[model samples]
Target: MPFIVTDACIQCKYTDCVSVCPMDCFVEGPNFVVIDPEGCIDCSVCVPQCPVDAIVNAAEVSPQQAEFVELNARLARAPGWRPLTQAKAPMDGHEQWAGVAGKRAHLRLTW
Candidate 1:
């Protein structure tokens, strides 16, 4: 299964995951990133690159964050989605939200 970027990624918006993805499966939004399920190779390289540990192996996704699997896939395939191939500085003030829970509600689904 592919790795799914989840709620912990909401305000953190780190591009570390994008830098190591062999398949270039990641898509970007204004304040978030999602891996395109169809494109991910399941190589698992992107997992450790995430500083917040926000990326979860799809099979291991907990019920609390299960919705994000589809969320990643949906947003990845959304119209006008763009590939984020280069790592940039994460959103400012990322430390404030790194461990914050229930951040799914704050995900910005568009660029």
Candidate 2:
């Protein structure tokens, strides 16, 4: 299964995973990064790069995070989402939001 970026990534927008991704599958949104399922090679290289432990194998996704399987794909195709290939600064106040949960509601679909 492909790796999926869960809601744990909602506001943090950490790009560490992006730099390690061989396929450059990650696409950035306003405040989050998602793996493009189509481009993801299921190599798991990006898994350890996520500080929030947001990246998970699709088969391992918990029920609460099940939506992210489709969410990542959808967001990767969103109008403003663009390839994220390098590690960069996280979103403003990322430290405060890093440990926060239930952040799916905070995801910004538009740039």
Candidate 3:
């Protein structure tokens, strides 16, 4: 199964995971990053790289994180969500948003 980017990454938008993805499957948005299901090689290298522990295996997602399995795929292909291959600064105010729950509502679909 492909790795899924979950709500923990919503407002944080940390790109540390992007730096370790061998397939370069990450797609960037204004406040999130998703793994392209089609491009991800299931390497799991990006998992530990995510400081917020947002990346999870598709088969292992919890009930709350289930939506992200499809969300990651959909967002990766969404218009204006482009491929991200390098590590960059996290979103503004990421420190305060880190570990904050219910961040799905703040997810930005476009850049």
Candidate 4:
């Protein structure tokens, strides 16, 4: 299963995980990051590097955050979302709300 980035990564899109990803499956989101299921090799290399503990294997994602697996895959295919390896400094600041509930509001999927 592919890994997914969770709400904890919002506004703190640390690129450390991006730097460690061997398959370049990670993709830059507006405020966080996502993994391309089609590209990820399940190497688990990017998980430990996340400063906010946002990365998780698709099947292991917490029930509250399980939607992220689909979100990540969908965003990965969306037009204009750039692959992580192709970006020079992909992680950029975006509006983030504290204590946002639900998967959609908490995770910054768009700029």
Report lDDT (CA) for all predictions.
Answer: 0.88, 0.91, 0.91, 0.74
TM-score-best of 1 and 4:
1
For residues 1-111, could you state the per-residue lDDT of candidate 2 as single tens digits?
A: 899999899888888888888888889989988999999999999898888999999999999999999999898899988888888999999999999999988988896
For residues 1-111, what per-residue lDDT tens digits would candidate 1 score against the true structure?
Answer: 988999888888999888888888898887888999999889999989998888998999999999998989889988767888888898998999998989978887665
lDDT of 4 by residue, 37-103 (tens): 9988889888888756788999898888887888888988877778887434424442243234343
The TM-scores, one per candidate, come to: 0.94, 0.97, 0.97, 0.80
Please list all clashing residue pairs in model 4, or write none if there are none: none
lDDT of 4: 0.74
| RMSD to truth, every model | 1.0, 0.7, 0.8, 3.3
Candidates 3 and 4 compared: the better one by TM-score is 3
Q: Who wins the lDDT comparison?
A: 3
**Least well predicted 10-residue stretch by lDDT in candidate 3:** 102-111
Count of clashes in candidate 3: 0
N/CA/C clash count, model 2: 0
**How do the candidates rank by lDDT, highest first?**
3, 2, 1, 4
lDDT per residue for candidate 3 within 26-105, as digits (tens), equals 99988999999999889999999989999999999999889999999898889888989999999889999998998988
For candidate 3, the TM-score is 0.97
RMSD of 3: 0.8
